[model samples]
Target: MNAYLILDLSINNFESFREYIEKIPLFIKKHGGRYIVQGVEPEVMEGDWCPERVVILEFPSKENAKEFLGDTEAQPLFSIRHKSTTSKLILAEGCS
Candidate 1:
């Protein structure tokens, strides 16, 4: 089965977040993850929930998704993201 990492984020500091945005792609590719969606505004169809920005990453499996999240090389970039944004992330298994 595949896995997806979904993110809903509100940016606080764009300058710092830019660094994270630039650097993270290399790490994502290294872990066999690809961006399905990146920093898109949500369009509410039926619910009251609204997100400032959303990102979705697809990986080969749940373990691969976990590995990407846990990658040591991406730790500094992750810190930049953490400091510059308020976000929620979820890892979900995809139907095969």
Candidate 2:
């Protein structure tokens, strides 16, 4: 089954976050993952929860997604994301 990583991020510093935006995709690609949706403001549908930026990534499998999450080389970029934005992320498997 394919897996997806969905992210809801609120950026605090775009200047600092730029590095993560530019570099993290390379890490994702290394792990057989690709961006399905890059950062974009979401439209609120039924809830009061508002998201500043949203990103969705697709991978061949859940394991691939996990590996990407745990990739050692991406740690620095992850740090940049942590420092620049408050983020909520979830990984879900698609129907087989």
Candidate 3:
């Protein structure tokens, strides 16, 4: 089954964050993951979860998702994110 990494991020430093954001797509591609959604304008029809930003990434499988997240080449970009935003992330398996 496919897996997804869903992120709800609140950015604090826009300029610094931009640099890191730019690097993510290539990293995902390198790991054979695809972007299902990235920072689309949110619609607040009704909910307490007014997430500032949302990203959903689809990977071939849960193992692929874990490997992508644990990649050493991608580790440094985290500091840029850490310095720029607070984020909530979850990994879940897709229904087969």
Candidate 4:
């Protein structure tokens, strides 16, 4: 099955987060991942949950998602993201 990485982020440091975002395209390319959604505006018609930003990345499989997350080359950029935002991330298999 295909896999997806979903992120809901609330940014505290916009400038630093911008830097992190700038670096992500190249990082994703290196890791064999592609952006399905990046910083997309979400419509919550009736919900208590209001997310600041949402991102979804599609990978070939769960193992690929894990490898991308665990890549040493990606760690510094990921650390910047960690420091700049509060985020919830999940790796899930996509339905056929």
Candidate 5:
């Protein structure tokens, strides 16, 4: 089964986030992950759920997604993200 990382973020510091963005792609690619959606304005059909930014990443499997999240190479960049934005991130497995 495939896996996805879904992110809803509100950026506090664009400059710091830019640095994180610049460094994340290589790690994503290395871990068999690709962006499905990035920083797009979302349509809210129902309740009061609106986000400043949304990111969706697809990985080969749940394990791969976990590996990407835990990657040592991405640690510093991950820290940057924490400082740059307030985010809610979730990992979900796709139906096989």
Candidate 6:
């Protein structure tokens, strides 16, 4: 089964976040993950949920998603993301 990592982000510091944007793809590819949806502002079809920017990534499995999220070498990049944006993230497994 595949897994997805979905992010809702409000970027406060674009300059810093840009660094994360530039660098994260390498890690994602390394972990067998690919972007399903990159940076996009979603159109709300339901009650009161408007995200500034949304990202969705797909991985081969839950383990791949977990490894991407927990990479030690990516800690600095994660910090950059954390400091530059108010973000929410979730991992969901696709139905088999």
Predicted structure with the largest lDDT when compared to the true one:
6
Full-model lDDT, candidate 1: 0.94
Tens-digit lDDT track for model 4 on 1-96?
A: 789999999999999988888887886777678999988878887969888789999988888889889989889999999999999999999998
* Cα misplacement distance, residue 47 of candidate 6 (Å): 1.5
What tens-digit string does per-residue lDDT give for candidate 3 at 1-96?
999999888999999999888897888888789999987757778978888889899998999889888888888887788878999889999999
- Cα RMSD of all models vs. native, in order, equals 0.7, 0.7, 1.2, 1.3, 0.7, 0.6
Better of 2 and 4 by lDDT: 2
The TM-score of candidate 5 is 0.97
Say which candidate scores most in TM-score.
Answer: 6
The predicted structure with the larger lDDT, 1 or 6, is: 6
How does candidate 3 fare on TM-score?
Answer: 0.91
**TM-score against native, each model:** 0.97, 0.96, 0.91, 0.91, 0.97, 0.98
Clashes of 5: 0
Please provide, for model 6 over 1-96, each residue's C-alpha lDDT reduced to its tens digit, 9 standing for 90 to 100: 999999999999999899999999999999999999998999999999889999999999999999999999998999999999999999999999
lDDT of 6: 0.96
Let me know the TM-score candidate 4 reaches against the reference structure: 0.91
Worst 10 residues of 4 by lDDT: 23-32
Q: Which ten residues in a row have the lowest lDDT in candidate 2?
A: 40-49
| TM-score, cand. 6 | 0.98
lDDT of each: 0.94, 0.95, 0.88, 0.89, 0.94, 0.96
Put the candidates in lDDT order, highest first: 6, 2, 5, 1, 4, 3
Off by over 4 Å in 3: none
Q: Candidate 4 at 27: error in angstroms?
A: 1.8
Q: Which stretches of candidate 6 lie over 4 Å from their true place?
A: none
In angstroms, the error of model 3 at 53 is 0.9
Residues 24-48, model 1: lDDT tens digits: 9998998899999999998988887
Tell me the tens digit of each residue's lDDT in model 2 across 1-96. Answer: 999999999999999999998899899999999989899888999979898889999999999999999999999999999999999999999999
